[model samples]
Target: MPESATLPSATTKLEYLRKDLEDLRYYLDEFSAFLPLSVIIVNPQGFILDINQAFENLIGLEKAGVLGSTVAKLFCEQEQFAELEARVLKGEVIKGARATLLLRDRQISRSLYLSPRHDCEKNIIGYFLGIYDISENVKLTEGRNGTVCARTIELEEKSEDLLRSRAALMNILEDVAEEQKKVEQERDKTLAIIKNLADGILIFDPHNVLTLINPQAKEMMQLDESSVVGKMAAALTKVTNIMPLINFLGRNIKKVYRKQLELKSDKVLEISAFPFLTGRETLGKMVILHDITREKAIETMKTEFVSVAAHQLRTPLTTVKWSLHLLLHGNLGAITAEQRDLLMRTDEHNERLIGLVNYLLDVARIEQGRFVLRNKNVDFIKLAETVIAPFLEVSKNKQLNFKFIKPREKVLPVNVDEEKMVLVIENLVDNAVNYTPPHGNVTVSLSFDKAKSEVLFTVKDTGIGIPEDNKQRIFTKFYRAENAAMASTSGSGLGLFITKNIIEGHGGRIWFESIQSKGSTFSFTLPLK
Candidate 1:
């Protein structure tokens, strides 16, 4: 029985040894299949015992090459190996400590998870180490940081663009608000003017809707202001046929003045339609009507008087002009120098009177719609020089500087009535020189821009400028600045009025800039072809 028991014990010990070897093989196979992760086994003395395929790949060395090597040999720094050894000695699991492993060509950084292994007696036996290659993750994480930084910079640029857009929008809104205020003020003034005028005034929208009617208009139409305020013209004037009035408003013409409309009450009314405009926008229409029954009779009587007076006055003026011309030209006979001088003086005074009469006639012709412009290609530079030559001589007498600045190139030619443009410049320069103090400067200039298709002629003078209070009224007929009147009494105050008419007739624009005691610049633009 003792011999049989010995035999069974020996077989059982052999079976236990085989099973332990098989388990070890299974663990080694499982660890080898783990990709991108390395498995390492070390003895208690920190010498490498076994390594998997991933371990060889991570350390850039073969398994056979690394086995039996001390752990300190793989670490580039001996200090890292010392730390791992201390953890192994303490029988503690050390996790996730990164170290650089040195190779011949490159240094590889690795993360290691080391754990202590012990026997049943609690004696330190070995260590299991797992290593991960973290170089790619490090590079990928740095790239991600760069991407985040770039995105932050892009967002900052977008924020600045949005801020600039907001500021531009605010400026546009402010400008619009300021323009709206000015419009409101002008509207109030126009309404006040309409109310105070003796002639009846009515305003209508494009839809033929009555927007406003002055008190005089309401009374003239024999209707209450409240009743006609929002009502249509057809409704208000139903008792009187208003077809002509409606047709006048609907006409394609921009402006039509002195349209006669006979009412049901047998009243003769003269209606004038003036289209109100804002830039290119047409706001609405304004109609002013005069009860011309009485005025028409008075006007007819005055027309007869003016014609009779002109006819009666022309013969005497003609005779006097011929008589002076004959004497001054020595046409009648040879005469003494003193007699000739006296005759020349009389001729000059008669010529001045004739010029005054001609000015009056021109104003009358313009008012009668008989004045017209003959537009032609005219060089403004030559025109300016010619007009200022006589004035320059006079300027020399006053010890003033008269200068002309012509364009370098031909610039652009203006289609204008040459006679009218010369007269316009002559009037402006004459006014400047007349008001200017002695030793002051007068400059005439012509400039043009082809892109805008416009030509600008300017007459600038160091003169007694118009005060702000009188600036607006300076263009009105017979209206002169206070200082201008005090400085020079010879002006008829019609130069600017006539110049404005001439420019408007040629489809041009005119304006002036001035300051009190700082002089003035009068500029006008002609369309260039």
Candidate 2:
């Protein structure tokens, strides 16, 4: 190493190194041409040295438009780059930093990173500014125009919970409204039922205020059309402490109470007061007052009739039984075979008469609403087959084709009083078989719809059909069709009436569709579950 060799190459080497450094910086700036982030080079003297294609796009300006301009020229006057330049000169690196820069058309907000570079001698040159468009980010963070990741998830959960709560509340409201409507309807029905009785009804609120008084009550109290409502019961009918006592019974009595109240008309009114309860809420008191004057007379008349009929029936039955016994035992005389046969027929008729009396007694109990049913789950198809077996045998003798078609799906189970349902089916099948003509077909089919949970039992007969005009009256007690009456004058008309009551008790419906001179199809539907 010669001293001359180092000294002669110093100036030339400096020029070459400076040119190489400028070329390297130029290439570095060119490398940013395809970058998505904007690139800007700023000298320590606050001058913009160069910019890339991204910078041109971000500012919406041409490359030549921003050449040789100060960095401050690309920003608002308020956002000058004086402090940023000072920081770069101090050798600080700002990564992922942000700022708002202004252009001709709009203010461009961006995230920027600053990197300061120097030569081998350590003289500060310029800073490389990497900028990302942060308009969407800023809106999401501060401007409130976009959804953030965390906030979006939270809002979604809250919205779901809110929607579920709203649906539940709506269902509750609908259920409550439906229950209220049912209660109102039941109340109206009760009012109508009690008003039809030969009694006076008065309903009072908790405060002893008269809420409702039926027409009978008004008549008994000598009240005009608008006299009783909203007035105290004590004031209206001079029944002191009656309303309060009635309210007390409604709320705290916990039992039905009966008392006698003296009406203004000098009549002793037998009153039965009961509480009106809806769910767990107690509404008020209901008082029913029966005059009992005409009812007492009717009861006396019924008692006299029972005594007389019983005595008359007992004497005849005793005489017939003794006479039949003597004839059967051969105690009276050694009669001929023909005479014995006559005596046996008389005994049979007497026994049938006694059976009729027993049947009438049973019916009387049922008509008075005292009959209790032993409800059980029964296979309806089997039950129907059992009840129709006898009728089918009898129909065979009549040369009527009796067909029982089992349902494809085996048996349908129904909850009902087995004995009562058996009686009903037997009567209906017998009626059909009796009315059907010779060589006619009596078909019974069973079907079920699983979706509706209903079972349909149909009995179709090819016989003389009923008339359309008499259909409604067929179910009435002691009422028989004209054709039926003419055909079977010995039958009691109570069979169909009892059948209807039994079917209704089991929550089933029975109806018949018939065409005159064609046939009749008697169909009944029962609940599956």
Candidate 3:
């Protein structure tokens, strides 16, 4: 009914394909019937399908009469046909084998080639045989007692051609040998890496069939070498802590997933997996299993000590902050201007120290899995407005124009920890405002991405953007970009790190785009319910 629907469909394509196939078969039959050298086509079951005119001439038979006959039953030696069948059907190409064909009244010696034809699935469907007349060259004999005459120049030319061929073949063989040596060396290096590795090695083929298990993996699993290969990797679930094989295969995780797994009683393995990719294919995963019980114990001890120390220092720090605030605000008594300025500076420095301590405590809580979220369904734009207000006043003092683009759909709700979400937005806007120069602008926006089913938050700043070297480590704690360090000296560098943790805890994603000396934009997305 539509103009575009008038084009050819599946039936049209099928008819075109039939026509092409018919033309191809006709051309092939003509070429084979006229060719001088003998050629034979046969089915996998060894029955002859067709033959060339040369083959029919040699055999003194009409091919149309013996189309379904077996080549081994006539026209060739029985022993050789059986040997050829065994070799060719197994996918080996046998070339230049000396075979004698039984002609009408005599035997003809020729060089034979037998090769199997396969379908896309690599199953043998038929065989192709080519016979070359090599009896003239093989029957030639050298002159008796090395004598030569002027009439022997053709034979001398043939000898020289043979010598050149021999030299060329030797060069090819040497090249092949060198290539083989390099391959062998590389193979040995890979095997050494696998066998001597502290972790296990499991290699699966493109078809998801396990093909290799090294000595280290065998030892770790206490498995017999013979039973592992040629099977699926699903067996790992029985003796190791890997997920069920279904989740493990074809998952291009793009990052290393580390897990502390108990393979058996008293056995602890730290497993890390990355989707093993080469060229363009995801192929499979490479998993490393390490014994990290001792490392875990050391980390646990370190975390406990820091937690205890932070709790002890919190009381004194709170007292200092409160005392400084009272003195600066004249709550205790009237103070001289200079004394107030001194107290104000002290209060600012004290706040910086307090922020650092809080960041450290938060990091510890995250590491210990003690950072808990109280999720509530809250209006998303209202949350953004509340956080954006403080940054507006802060930026105005520095002459940076602050902007907040409210979402068109202003009533979207998201389930999140309200306090933690505020921390994320505050850190982003604070960083943007702090980094931008006077008269520069900072913008924050909220929007719903219907395709991803997520609410997007973006912070754009006309600031001295992150340098190339520091961009990779921007989210790492205590890592400040060179430009950022040059522009300001007061930041703790823990904001983005904390922001990343909070966002991921909310099942969100965060990333940024920046160019040095130009500007930067940080974007994050949270799910909208």
Best by lDDT: 3
RMSD to true structure for each model, in Å? 31.9, 31.3, 20.6
Please write out the lDDT profile of model 2 over residues 1-529, one tens digit for every residue: 9778667477798999999877755654444564555667665666675676877987888878776567766655435456766787789977656667887767767766676755445556666676665565556676343458766575567557534533333333333344545766998998898677667887777665678878786666555646557876456444432444344344333345556554444566666776687655567777776776556457546645644564567568878978897988899878889988998998888886664554444355455565567888888878887888788678879999889988777655788788888777777777788788899989988888788788888889988788888788988766777777777435667677777777776788999888766888888888876
Clashing residue pairs, backbone N/CA/C < 3 A, model 2: none
- Lowest-scoring 10 consecutive residues by lDDT in candidate 3? 245-254
lDDT of 3 by residue, 1-529 (tens): 9976998998998999999867765655565565556777677778786676887887788988668666787646788678888899999988777777777688877877787765545667667777667655544445343444532575567557544533333333333344545766999998788878877777665555566777776666567767656766555445343333324433332234676665444556666766577556666756665767678778778878877887888888899999998887779999999998888888888888787788878877987999888999988888889988887788889999888998766455799999999989989988898888999989898899888889999999999998888888999877888878777556878889889999999999999999988899999999976
- Candidate 1 per-residue lDDT, tens place, 1-529, comes to 6777656586788999999867755654653554345667676667787776766766677777777677877778878678777877788877668888777688888877776655445566666676666665566556777875776586567557534533333333333344545766998998899899999888877655678878787777775666556666555445343445665555332477888876777677988887787656676788888998877667556645654565566678778999988877878898999998888888777776665555555565565677788888877777777888899789999988888888787665678899878879888998888888999988888888777788888989999888999988987776788988888447777678889999988888999999879799999987885
In model 3, which runs have C-alpha deviations exceeding 4 angstroms?
1-190, 219-227, 235-297, 329-332, 450-452
TM-score of each: 0.49, 0.42, 0.63
The lDDT of each candidate is 0.74, 0.69, 0.75
Ranking, TM-score, top scorer first: 3, 1, 2
> Model 3 lDDT vs. the true structure?
0.75
Against the correct fold, how does model 3 do in TM-score? Answer: 0.63
TM-score of 2: 0.42
**Cα distance off (Å), candidate 1, residue 332:** 3.0
Backbone atom clashes (below 3 Å) for every candidate? 0, 0, 0
Instruction: Please give the lDDT score at residue 502 for candidate 3.
Output: 93
Q: TM-score: which is higher, 1 or 2?
A: 1
